[model samples]
Target: MLTKFSVTAAAEKFMRRVVRFSGLPSSAGFRLLVRTGGCSGYDAEFSAEVEARTGDETIEVHGLRIFLPAESRVLLDGLKIDFIETPDRSGFAFIKDDQRSVVAVSADVARIDVSAIGRG
Candidate 1:
């Protein structure tokens, strides 16, 4: 798969549902980013970006691709990305990476298998 880690059935299923409903093409990819906001000082956002690899960790969720910036990896440590497609709203969220307030970035993401971690 495109991701370094595996994904969960729930995550995979959700991804497909979103894509199917969005009617986007196969070449489309989901972009993950970290920005300042919320009470947590930073939050995550996902969209579509076709830029070059930037050496970041690219994970595959469901049949779609999730791109993480190379420098943003540590911030995403222990970060759990999830897709929530509700009747009113549909998008991805930063479920969890590291609950602890450390260096904003984390080393935890390095140990995770994007695909397998989702199932866990």
Candidate 2:
């Protein structure tokens, strides 16, 4: 089966740190899922799991197991997972392997459409 996403070496190291700090067992793995609602219309969610759930596709990179749900396969194809640390923030980030920016709109611009938003 084709790989839907990739985990960077830095990400692997970060996962190891997380596992060590969280007291997760050696068998622990990460699950990546796609959910609606983000600047680009979708978001990648991560969770720690002890074992693969039904319909999950497991991919191991350098002995680290990363699980992807069958439903999220298409949305996450060609994705690159990395760990970034900065003075202000430090965490995992998902980037498109194709190099496209995740934020579809410019940060300086505000897009608001009254017609598109309906009141319940």
Of the candidates shown, which would achieve the greatest TM-score relative to the real structure? 2
**Residue lDDT tens for model 1, 8-114:** 45546654543444445556565556665544456554444444267756666544766777644655555555445556644434444344323232112232233
- Model 2, span 1-120: residue lDDT tens: 566677778878866654444445777886767655666565555656778899888888777777878766766678776766666655556677677654221121122223322233
- Candidate 2's C-alpha lDDT? 0.62
Model 2 alpha-carbon miss at residue 96, Å: 2.7
Q: How many pairs collide in each candidate, listed in order?
A: 14, 0
TM-score of each: 0.47, 0.66
**Model 1 scores what on Cα lDDT?**
0.48
